[model samples]
Every structure is written in C-alpha cells, then in structure tokens.
Target: MVSKLKSANASAAGQITSRSPRQIAWRRFRRNKVGMVSAGISIVVLMLSLFAPVVCKILGINPDELNLDLIDSSGIPTLPNGGISWEHPLGLTPGIGRDLLANLLYGSRISFLVAFLTTGLAIFIGLIVGIVGGYFRGRIDDYLGRFTDFLLAFPAFFMIVALSEPMVARIQETGIAQGNGARVIFLIFFLSFFGWPGFSRLVRSQVLSLRERDFVTAAQAMGASRKRIIFKELMPNLWAPVIVVVSLSLPGYLAAEAVFSFLGIGIQPPATTWGILLDNARRFVTVYPNFFLITAGSLVLVVLAFNLVGDALRDALDPRSER
Candidate 1:
C-alpha cells in the first residue's frame, strides 16, 4: 500500500512539472488584464493594416485613387460637409480628397512593418555579437565592446536625419530603391543599423552573468563545441530578457519611422503612411483640424498600445514579480 501511494505521488509531481516555461509565462501574461487587452488591440490594428485592401473595398473607398469631386475650389476637402460619412468614414483629406480611412489602414501597414522588421534585424545582429563576445571574453569581447560603445556615443537620430535624404536620393538615382518598396527597405536598414547597439549591450551584459553559470561550465566540460554551447545552451537561457528588450524597443522604432516620414525622409507621396499623412495634414491644420487629428490620434493609439503591452510583458516575465 505504501509503495502504491509513493508511486501515485510521483505521478502527480510529474504532472505538475509538465508545463513549459513559455506556457507558464503566457498564463502569467493573461492574468494582467491591461496587457491582454493591449495585446488584442495591437493584433486588431495589425490585421486592419494587413488587410487594408479588403477593408477599403468593404468601405467603398480608394486610398490612392483621387476624388477631385470631393475637393472644393480652394482644394480643401469639403469639411463637416464631408465629415463622417458611410462612404468616407473618417472623412477625407482636405486638399487631396483621399479617403482618410483607407490612407490610415495603408499607413498602418508601413508603420507596423517598419517597426517589426527593424526590431527583428536588430535582435538578430545583437544576439550574434553579444553571444560571441560574451562567450569568448578577452580580445573578442574587447573589440566588440569598443565598437558597440563607439556606436552608442553618437546621436542616432541626428545621424539618421543627416544621412536619410542623401542616402535615399542616391538609392533612387541608382535605380536601387526606386519605388515605395525601396524606401521601405532603406528605412528598415537605416533603423536596424542604428538600433542594434543598444540591444547588443543588453545581451552582452546578460551573457556576462550567464557564461559562468554551472550549465555553461558543465557543457564545456562535456566536450560540447563552442558554437553548440552558445546556440543550444546559452541561447535558451537568454530568451526571457531578449523578449523583454524586443517588446520595449518596438515602440521606439515605430516612433522613429513616423518621425522620418514626417520629416520628408520617409515614405513619400503615392505611399500613404501616417507620418506622410501628418506632413500633408499640417498644411491645412488651421482650416481642417480633422485631418491632423485623425492621423495623429492613430499614431498615438498604436504607440500607447505597444508601450502598455511591453510594460505588461516585462512585469509578467520578471521572475521576482509576485503576479
């Protein structure tokens, strides 16, 4: 009877330990109502952006196609007269007569794409640099550390602003980045280039603490290859912090892309982005405040949603958090 009882207890313990770290983290995240709601909002925004064409069709408006009929003699979209209609839900651009809803959907596509792609690239580069540097401390670490410091010393935004116009112009002139596609790629590269160093530093710090842990030492003693230890052993342990960094950094990248667009260095005409929309709306802000309000409001909502989600993730994943 005692043997049977011991066996049952063992089985129960195994069942309790079956849950993976990811599953546990997810359970914790779901408990945070604010985070869960923000995540849902972010998902909805992404879907709307991804399916902008279909959304536009359902709404019966063309984002890029001109609607000169809607424009007045002064070239401003007919205001309150044009405001909040079934055909143009968010009203129309004052001077251009483009559907505000359609433009917003398309613009969201650019903003979200830039933020995610740049963050992905930065994470990839940072991971490689940090893992290698931290694993092989000494000369390799010194060289990489200096390079990262050098990058951090510069004002990243200023560098982007100064280089964007000339770099974009050259790419266009060379037929390298001709259309909106080229501009998007350029922005991705530009943002990723400036963004990686911070993450690299973060990863390097974490790696420094982890490299001396027992698992790493045990892996080394067992004749595991350096690459194997770094990728298989070390990488798994780094996921928690990496995820937190990625989440926190996304909003910053989104804001940067918007700033680039607003400054005329981002996606240009024929390509509707929130930043570009804001740039155009600014001219008619006095006469038609709706145009500016709609675009700015959308930007604010996305940024705020991302920030809230990130904060929630940080708290949820924090091992010390009681929640």
Candidate 2:
C-alpha cells in the first residue's frame, strides 16, 4: 500500500500532465511502428521529389534528354544489368537513354502535385455542398443530395476515357491550354469534377450528427449568426475527418493519374510519370523484367505507405479508441 501510494504520487507529480489533442495524436502515432516507418518513407520520397531539379542539376543529368549512344542498333539499352553505372545510378531506361533515377524523381514530384491539387478541389467542393445541405436539412438538402448521387452513379471513369482525345482537342481549340498542358487541365477537371460526391456524402453524414451537439445548440441559443455557427462551431469539428479523408484520397488520385497516363489519356508526352513508365514497360517486359519491376514496385510502395498512414490517422484521431 505504501509503495503503491508512492508510485501514484510520482505519476501525479511528474508523469501525468494534460496534453492537447495534437500532442496526444502525435504520441499515439509514435507508438505505431508501422505508421512511423511509412511516414518516414513518405517524407523521404516527397523531399526527393520536391528537390528533384536541384538533385538532377548536381548530377548533371536531364531526365528528358535522349542519349542516342546508350541505345544500341537493336533499340535496347547497352547496359547489361539495369544500367547501374557511375554515370547512371538507377540505370538507363531501356530504349530511351534518359536517366532512370532522374525520371523517377521527377515523376514522383509531378504525380503528387496533381494528386494534391485534385484532392484539394474535391475537398473544397464537398465541404461547401455538404455543410450547407446538412445544416438546412430540407428541400435544399434533397436537391444537393440528388445532384451528388447523380455524380456518384454516373460513369465518370468511362466518360474520361471515351472523351479524352476530343476533350484535349476541344481544350486546345479554346486556347486555354495545349498539348499535355491542356490534357493536364482536362484531367484535373475530370477527376475533381467527379471525385467530390463521396467526400460530400461523408461530410454531410458527419454534419448531420454534429449539428445537434451541445456546443452547436449553445451557439444557436446564444443567437450566433447561421454562417458563424456553421463555420465556427461545426466546421472546426470537421477537420479530423477531413484530414483522414484527404490522406486516404491521395493514393486513389495518384493511381488514377497513372492509369489515365498508361491509357494515353492522362498528362501527355514529355512528362515523366510512373504511368507513362509502366505503359512503356509492357513493350520490354519479357526482355527487361527489371524495368517493369522498378516502375511497378515504386508505385506499390508509395500507395501502400499512403494507405498505412491514412489508417494510422483514422485510428489516432478516433476519440473513442484506446491509446
């Protein structure tokens, strides 16, 4: 009993202190070994991607520059084993003598940038439609709900594929954007245009319940402006889920970019993307299996890392979950 009392006293005096939610979340996240490892990998990849240009400058390599010497008469890379030489770190791309490491790094940067932009646009549209619909909960909600449902049921992927060529042409005709630039604008539009319904539904469901909370009710009783109550009272509480949703949504958009690029509909030529690499990989898969492996492996690694981090965030932010 005396020992127990002393231990409790020690904890109360030194070991125990009130932690903010952010601190508690970080503590819980650190306890998650898999999450920590994945986060480190993600941070490393993002950093490398962000500084790809500087790194390439230091290495004196242009990712898009074609080195005809590296290509043999047979159109296969001259290097015997995946191009790992003093000049080329990861290797020379099979038919194209562009540096593999350089392309990979640049690909990472562009792919993530597109994913981030698409996710942001989707989240913004979702937030607006969701909060308004949930708070009003009447004819207004019904109209908004139906619109989102229509988007959910629509064949967005097929539409994108079917319209890709003409869409790019149309955008180019309008002089808004051209070449792959136009394609990029079209791709971002198609993605975010159709991608928002799911998140909107998630937010609406959350807002529906959160609106009746004690704090919200107190705000209402205190004659807070509708706009203020919605933005201040409810929106602040929505951040946790919004963050988790955003984290989870990125990989999907990343894959989407890769898929469209592979199919010749995504960001156009001269762009170094994993999808473009994979699309090219099919031609040499039988002879140069390593080529396929590196591209596919990189994609798998980044996606898995993102998914694990998203799961960790979901767990860490759940108020009911045990530490």
Candidate 3:
C-alpha cells in the first residue's frame, strides 16, 4: 500500500513538471485582470498597425497620396462654414490635404516597428555585455560597470541629436544609405548603441546575484564548461527579469523614436511616424482639437498599456509574490 501511494505521488509530480515556464507564466498572467486587459489592448493596437492597408481601404484614404486641390488647414465645422464634416473625420491640416486616419495608421506602423526592432537590438547587446561582465567578475566587470555609468552620465537625447545629422550625412556620402532602407537601418543602429547600456546594467545586476546561487555552483562542480554554464545555466535563469524589462522598455523606445522623428532626425517624410503626426497636428490643435486628441491620445494609450503590462509582470514574477 505504501509503495503504491508513493508511485502515484511521483506520477503527479512528473506531470506537473512537464509544463513549461512560459505556459506557467501565461497561466498566472491571465489570472491578473489588468495584465489581461492591457495585453488585449496591446494586441489590438499591434493588429491595427499590422493590417493598416485594410484600415486605409475601409477609411477610403490614401496614406501617402495627397490631394493638393482642397484648402489645406480647415478647422472643425461647428457652423455651416466651420469646414469639417463626416468626409474628413479629424478635419484638415495646415498645408496638406492628407487623410488624418490614413496618416495616423501609417505612422503607427513606423512607431511599432521602431519599438520592436530597437528593443530586440538593445536586448541582444545587453545580454552579451551582461553575461560577460557577470560571469568574469573582477577587473572586467569593474571596467564595464564604470564605462556604462560614464555613458549614462551624458544627456542622451542631446547626444543622439548631435550625432544624428553628421551620421546621416556620412551614410549618404558613402552611398550606403542613399535610400529609405539604409536610413531606417542607420536609425535602428543609432538607437541601439545608445539604448543598450541601461539594459546591460540591469542584466549585470541580476547576474551578479544569480551566479552565487547553489544551482550555478553545482553546475560548475559538474565539470560544465564556462560556455555551457553561461548559456545553458545562467541564461535560462535570466529570462524572468529580461521579459519584464523588455516589456517596460518597449513603450519608452517607441516614445524616443517619436521624439527623434518629431525633431526631424527619425523616419522622415513619405515615412510618417506618430511623433511626426503630432508635430504636424500641433499647429491646428486650437482649430480642430480632435486632430490632436485622437492622434496624441492614441499614442498615450499605447504607451500606457505597455507600461501597465510591464508593471503587472514584475509584480507577478516577484519572488515575494504569493504562489
């Protein structure tokens, strides 16, 4: 009877162990109402941005093709001659007869793309620096830690702006980035270099704490090579903090991209961005407040959703969080 009971318990434990960490995370994440709600919002926004062509078709607007005939900057119609109608939902802008809905959708695409790409780049760079600094731990770690601090001390935006114009000109001269693709790639790289230090510092801090744990010590004792220990052992342990940080950093990166574009250094004309749309919309806010409200309001919602989700994940994954 005792032997049979022990066998049943082992079977139940084995079944429980079969579930992956991601599957477990999803289960916990779904139970949190705010996380689920914000996740739903994020998904909807991403879908809208991804299927922009369909949206443009339904809205009956060409995002890029402009109409020169219409009066450029008409405000919202209150009286018979106040100017806006159902045809122009958000009303017209200063000098461009472009569809506000279409431009907003197009800009969403750029903003989303920049966020996704830059986050990926930042994580990759951070992971490499972090793993190296943490695993080696000595003069190497000290040097890297100090250097990251030094980089962080600078005013990031001003530095990016100062670097951008010269870099873009240099790339154009090299005939490397004469077109849109090159320009986008350069922008991605530019953002990546400046962005990684923060993530690297975060990862390094996590690694320092994790490396002294019993599992890592055991792995080292088992004759595991440094590569195997770092990649197989340490990397797996780092995923929780990584996921939380990435989700939080995404919105910030998107906002930064918008700021860059607004300043005329990011995705230029013919390639609209949420920041650029807001920049153009600023002049007509007093006239047609809806123009600013819809575009800027949407930007705020997207950023807030990401931030809220990140906050929930951090709480859920916290060591002190109740099981």
Best by lDDT: 2
- The candidate that achieves the highest TM-score relative to the unseen native structure: 2
Error of 2 at 140 (Å): 0.8
Ranking by lDDT: 2, 1, 3
* lDDT (Cα, 0-100) at 61 in candidate 3: 69
Residue runs of model 1 more than 4 Å from their true location after superposition: 1-18, 79-82
Q: Which residue pairs in candidate 1 have backbone atoms (N, alpha carbon, C) closer than 3 angstroms, thus clashing?
A: 77-94
Which whole-number lDDT from 0 to 100 does residue 301 have in model 3?
A: 93
If scored against the real structure, what TM-score would every candidate get? 0.92, 0.94, 0.86
Question: Alpha-carbon error at 221 in model 2, in Å?
Answer: 0.9
TM-score computed on alpha carbons, candidate 2:
0.94
Kindly list the per-residue Cα lDDT of model 2 for residues 35-153, writing each as its tens digit: 88988988888888899999899988779888778788755687777677778877778787788889999987778988999999999999989999999999999999999989999
Which residue pairs of candidate 2 clash? none
lDDT score of residue 293 within candidate 3:
82
Residues 1-323, candidate 3: write the lDDT tens digits. Answer: 99999999999888875657677677777788998899899998889899999977886667766455655335333323223456655544445667777787778888888889989998999999988998899999999889888987888778778887777778888887675555566778877877899889888888888899998999899998999989898999899988998999899988888887878888787678888888877877786666678778989999999998998898777767653
Off by over 4 Å in 2: 1-15
